[model samples]
Target: MAKEETVLQGMIDRLIEIGRCYGMEMNVEKTKLMKISRQPTPATIKIDQKQLENVKCFKYFGSLLTDDGRCSCEIKSRMAMAKAAFSKKKNLFTSKLDLNLRKKLVKCYISSIALYGAEIRTLRAVDQKHSESFEMWCWRRMEKISWTDYVRNEEVLFRVSEQRNILHEIRKWKANWIGRVLRRNCLLKEVIEGKIEGRV
Candidate 1:
């Protein structure tokens, strides 16, 4: 662990050198650093005598990543994004389309948005509840069922002829991702197995 900062600095220096060789300059001022740890301390990485800002959370490839290595925030962000996406196509989803086709559309669009990078997420009971709630929200909105109607989730599922399968889908995705990772001889597999050298 003590060598982590040194190794990171070395990598940064090498990257800078390569950029210079390619006539490309790195914008150190715009660069951010994040360290994932249960008890994280401040990291000071300097470039051109300017310290890079350390962030508690940041977005990468449309997914929220936090210093605590927890995916709760990411899940919440995904839910929000999914809701926004649903709102954009609210007319189509709530149109007079066939129930089966609407369900399939929800699965392909809203669910995909919500489940982006879900395979790498570590979901707790609360996260699972949030996901289920998002799933129900989608169904309720598609059916144009008002919250004041006080319709039960089972009734909603029955009306939609569907089951609560978001959690199941996430689990399946995670299982498949794990299988692929286990079969590969790569850095990710080594990291998952805690077999990386110089890692504490």
Candidate 2:
């Protein structure tokens, strides 16, 4: 931490100096430094001689990044957004449409909403449970199978007739997204290269 703080401060100082040389101004009010570690920073970071606030978490690219790096916050936020999306099209889900049509709607709309920001996520078992709960909730609603019906979960899957469950969909979408990222030879691919290679 000591070394990283010193190096980070030096980088920030250089950035400010370069920006000044180019006659560019940084928005000091919006500037803040986030340290992603359990240990407190030994030194304060400054931008243009102003102290930057340290926060436990920060929102970036529509995802919640925390010091501990747990993804629960982001997952909950995604669930809310996806539920809202489903609610927006409630009429379509509850309509007398074909089973296949409603299934398509769930994939196209709610799945898109829920799976946003999830492509790069390393989902833990708890996270997977939450995701699966939401997916089964949708399936149950689509089949009009109340808890009172006392039907087995297998029955629900049988009723839906969709081969790909939510987890499968997640895996497929994430694979597709990663393929695109890899094809572009992007920075993310560079970061993931060693992990994927080592695992193989």
Candidate 3:
């Protein structure tokens, strides 16, 4: 009488014998075996996982969705870039004592631009305006400051100036009115600082 062969046991015995002959070792811990169901067509799978999980997902790179349920990685990346630029500028603009102070400064930046020399103001604006983006305005202001008589760092001056120019061109290409406001405000800030005069 012959012994009946166990399906999984027989497969493991065959694999081990083959591996021994080839002087190789198989990592059973890293291996998985599956049995297919009796179906003629392949099964479909739907993943309901959230892409922007902060704990397990990558930082500065995650899925962002709109209020309308549009999952756009490109839009998220652009927003992230804008926020990063604002963050870098905010670091240079304020003291580094408290983490919460940066948020306050950003809120101030938004409010300052929104007021725009207004009187009797109540609540401050926290959202972006059609006239300018906070990121662009920050770079423009930095450049304006760098060119002042008190600041003698030519490298910083040139870098901020160059960046402002590049951002200006990008805004122009996008036909954004913010570009015009950026230029006007930049010139105005420079004038106020007594760095340059006469028609910007």
Per-residue alpha-carbon lDDT of model 3 for 28-96, expressed as tens digits?
544433223233222222112212111211222233322222223333344455556555665455544
Candidate 1, residue 15: CA error in Å?
2.8
lDDT of 1: 0.91
Candidate 3 has its poorest 10 consecutive residues by lDDT at 49-58
TM-scores of the candidates are 0.85, 0.78, 0.20
Please give the TM-score that candidate 2 achieves against the real structure.
Answer: 0.78
**Candidate 1 wrong stretches, greater than 4 Å:** 1-3, 186-200
lDDT, candidate 2, 93-183, per-residue tens:
9789998889989888888888887878878999999998888878887777788889877788888885437788778879999898776
Best by TM-score: 1
The residue pairs in collision within model 1 are none
In model 3, the number of clashes is 0
Which 10-residue span in candidate 1 carries the lowest summed lDDT? 191-200
Rank by lDDT, highest first: 1, 2, 3
lDDT-superior candidate, 1 or 2: 1
